[model samples]
Target: MSTTTKTNHIGRKISRIRELRGMKQETLAEVMGISQQSISHIENSETLEAEKLGKVAKALGVTKEGIENFSEENVINYFNNFNDNSFSNSQGTFNANNCTFNPLEKLMEVVEENKKLYERLLKAEQEKNIYLEKLLGK
Candidate 1:
């Protein structure tokens, strides 16, 4: 059996990382001040210049070394071994139970209350205007 080694294609790595980060090519191009065609050409290329690579790294929010060392297998392994429990260990610094309510839900409730209050205030103003109009008619 022949053992074929995988080539370290930096462009592919950048494309993959950008995709994983939920960024479109146009977005990356805008961030790098380049055109979408340029981004596409870069992704299609197997190699890139150091300066261009540095700029791409910055646009992609990764270090040059990170781009060079990126691999699908490594990313998969990282996600597979990822754990959220590290945020709260035996240390008292972090307490997950400290948040008694969902902030988003609370904000929604406040928004709804404000909307109701605004409607009530609008109705009261309309009634006052109607009363003033009736008094002036006399």
Candidate 2:
């Protein structure tokens, strides 16, 4: 199969969320008023008409766009555009030359070793502050 078809296959897999939510195929079929075989066919097929896709997305509580686009760029653009409001708070006093780590994002994780090492650095900072205060008689 073509790469586009393969991507659509991945979209089909997303339909499994209904089952993972403890919904039987028969249940979805009943709610949809369609046969279980039809639901199975839909979940197994890689391509669908726009109207059919909308029905499935509505039944699955997902946006139709979530299933239709097979392009990576399209997906990325959708997610970035979805968070357009997040970047509207750019009123801070930021000098381009003095700044680091632009393009704000979420923290992935911190390693346990890195955590312990940072604890030591924090202690060193406290000691330095104490020494500076003592020198100034504060």
Candidate 3:
């Protein structure tokens, strides 16, 4: 006979991923149209309803499976792999058949572009909040 151990704590996983992504409970609550206390309750539970989990996953900018399968060790491994020097040459370029490839440079360019996109998204969210506050003032 085999005993199955339930090791996946969905709520804690959600909280950890949220913190890793630099998101606060208040921000997640605003996106989910819930209260901060509600977010707190969700984070303390071992399991979540499928619908609410989906909502939380969406608000956190990750898929439900991502939250379910997240492991801190895996994230650390990914960072270590990313920082490995073997991926780059001494000149920071890849040499292949008389062609020099600098994929790291290209990756950095995309990362910069993504940063700009996130900044725009944050600005838009702030503007929307300001507009909502004005509506509340009326």
TM-score for each model: 0.61, 0.42, 0.57
Q: CA shift at 78, candidate 2, in angstroms?
A: 15
Q: How close is candidate 1 to the true structure, as a TM-score?
A: 0.61
Worst 10 residues of 3 by lDDT: 81-90
lDDT of each: 0.88, 0.67, 0.86
Report the C-alpha lDDT of model 1 over 67-138, residue by residue, as the tens digit.
Answer: 999998888866565455334223433433466789999999999999999999999999999999999999
| Best of the candidates, lDDT | 1
**TM-score-better candidate, 1 vs 3:** 1
Candidate 3 residues 1-138, lDDT tens each? Answer: 779985788888999999998999999999999999999999999999998999999999999888888998878865665533333423564433453668899899999999999999999999999999999999
User: Using TM-score as the measure, what is the rank order of every candidate, best first?
Assistant: 1, 3, 2
Alpha-carbon lDDT of model 3: 0.86
Order of the predicted models by lDDT, top scorer first? 1, 3, 2
**Top TM-score: which candidate number?**
1
